[model samples]
Target: MDWNELAMELQKEVSGQVLTREPMARHTTWRVGGPADLLVIPDTIKDLSATFSFAADHALPVTVLGRGSNVLVRDGGIRGIVVKMFRGLTSMTIIGEDVVAEAGCYLPFLARAAAVHGLSGLEFAAGIPGTVGGAVVMNAGAHGDSMGDVLVQVEVMDSSGNLTRVPAGLLQLGYRTSRLMDTGETVVKVYLRLRRDEPVEIRKRMQANLARRRALQPLNMPNAGSVFKNPANASAGQLIDRCGAKGLTVGGAAVSEKHANFIVNKGRATATDIITLMEMVRRIVWDTFQVHLEPEIHIMGEG
Candidate 1:
């Protein structure tokens, strides 16, 4: 089906923010992608469900993005529809000792909310820049704590367009990956099991974690948080650094000096530049260490 016709039909049925030819640069952290054919920001679950039904009926390809923190959109943009869940879907509540977060809730915000309620298991996520859905899908972690450790259950939208709640044990979270992404399922909510802790202690731990991230990560730059997955037994950043790939520039994209695993957009970087830099680092690291690096950042669209 033609995009304009589909968009018009969607506009008629869906009550949500819709944009045509939306710029991907504005939707991702790297800020270097072209425009998508259509973008939908559903404010409510009903809207999201209706939009999904429409796309499924039309056999349209769909991509759901959360916060745009750990993804890179290519220069050619994405085809079909891009559905982003952000502030509109944000809803967080504490049930007993568990914190249930909607997909749109930011990880940091979730951590802060949990801390405010004296919940302690989420302290490690206070420094994560992605959303709850993204964190759950990727098993995002740092400072010895991971989502796999705290998540009790996840509510997900199956490929058949049904939302089902699954136990965390069924998620099969393994180092920077989850069954959700591997199986092409969309996570809509998460229930985190947490313990009661001193509010002051939770805040202090979050502060320390944030300080450590600030000291080591290139937060001030426009970049996907981590470009490559850590190797089975070693760090990708250290491997890239050993190959002297840090501070190397391709156009305006440079391997970050602060964290070699990150490729920062230094104003006006094309997606091609990022791709080139990534390839260079991979090649050099492979040559020196015989370890092929895998990308942690989800790369999309085209360039």
Candidate 2:
């Protein structure tokens, strides 16, 4: 698709950096993936819209990425255009009991901001390593709370560059999933409804949640948080551990001993290694408990 020429054209159309054959590894937390055909990092909502329009005109597929925390890009990489929303589009505002955040704003940072503003609902997000858009799409949670609980609405951009404001209820948010997962629409902004609280108390709760996450998760290594979602009435981690899948290895990937649901990259792990290990763990848990564990992390790209 003459990606280099397309990259040049896209750069001229949008106020953003455009690159050809950019490595997907550089964008994801797991740091294991091949190169993308084209990568665009937009500077503003206008820039993002222009890029989307350009892609639509060219009939190129678009893949949107947030913090890349809960994704696994395959080793064969991604085709078409990959739009990364991080350094750009991260403006946030707090008004009364509500917070308005751009899609790229880090979830943890938003949680801290809410606490600073004496808000109570986001303390559970203090340790989640994703962006607001990603949190909403995946219904990301920690400490028994999720984005679905506080989200009011979101601004999403479709492939043809049309933007719409969708209420949280319309998203059908449930158990680490939402209708957005299949829509190919990109979340541009988020509106959250939080309650006023004592700042000191909010920070205290956030601190406790962060501490618990640090103690329970494999934060020391390069990992994509939890690999599998808990089945109905069952913990995916406990089931995997019960099946003796912890510490099991496939190439450079291994099930974390501290948390069975995590597959850590023990230096030089490939996407294939992580995926193989996940399958092995899934098979073992299914064999032992007869519960089918579903993936919480989004798997993308080719292969």
Candidate 3:
């Protein structure tokens, strides 16, 4: 059967919002990308499982999105089903020194929630714009701390629709990657171990982190946080700056003048523009310093 036939059958089998030819730009941070064959926003774990099962039965490929902060969807768009665990899955609970966060919970929201409950470990994540699930998949971090530092365990659903809880050690988190991205298991819940601190102190630290980010990042522009990862003990932004890749432009995408690592969208920037700019920066930096900058953002969809 064709995708339209599968969509019609899925509408009857699950309780979730389903859309065909959904524009990827509307769901991504960069605001660029074409359409997906199918987009499903599951309201609950059962609904998500059912959707996955339906895809499996149809032999359809799957792409799961978090809060869309660290991804760049290509202009050609994605094929098959795109599953987004949002809205209904956004829940947080404080259990003593531990915080239980649903996958859809945004990093900043989760950090604020933990602070309200007198938690301290999440203060470092206050400026990270991705979701808890996305953070786990990429081991997202800033300053000197990271998600793996506070993560106790993660509950994930396999592609087979089976749920499993994996410990932090087994997650293989390092720099900006985790095993989850390669394994393609859907992050459902996260258990975080935090410290009890004065709410005022926690908020102050969060504010400090935010202020630092503001000073170093292009927060006023439309762009993902960092385009490239730092290599070894060196900084990616500093390297880009040294190579004079800053202020470089490709179409409507240009490296942020404020920060060399960020490639900002100049209003009408397309996915191709962003990708082209990134490639240009990589090539220049490599030739100038013999150091290749690896991309921090996840690029998805077809070519």
Per-model CA lDDT versus the true structure: 0.88, 0.90, 0.89
Give Cα distance to truth, residue 277, candidate 3, Å: 1.0
Q: Among these predicted structures, which one has the highest lDDT?
A: 2
Local distance difference test, candidate 2: 0.90
* Candidate 1: residue 163 Cα off by (Å): 1.3
Order candidates by lDDT, high to low: 2, 3, 1
C-alpha lDDT (0 to 100) for residue 209 of candidate 2: 89
Higher-ranked by lDDT: 2 or 3: 2
Off by over 4 Å in 1: 1-5
lDDT of 3: 0.89
lDDT of 2 by residue, 106-188 (tens): 88899998999898999999888888998999998877888999999999998777899999999999989999999989999
TM-scores of all predicted structures? 0.96, 0.98, 0.97
Model 2, position 229, has a per-residue lDDT of: 91
Candidate 2: list runs displaced more than 4 Å: none
lDDT of 1: 0.88
In model 3, the clashing pairs are: none
C-alpha positional error of residue 256 in candidate 3 after TM-score superposition, expressed in Å: 0.5
Best by TM-score: 2
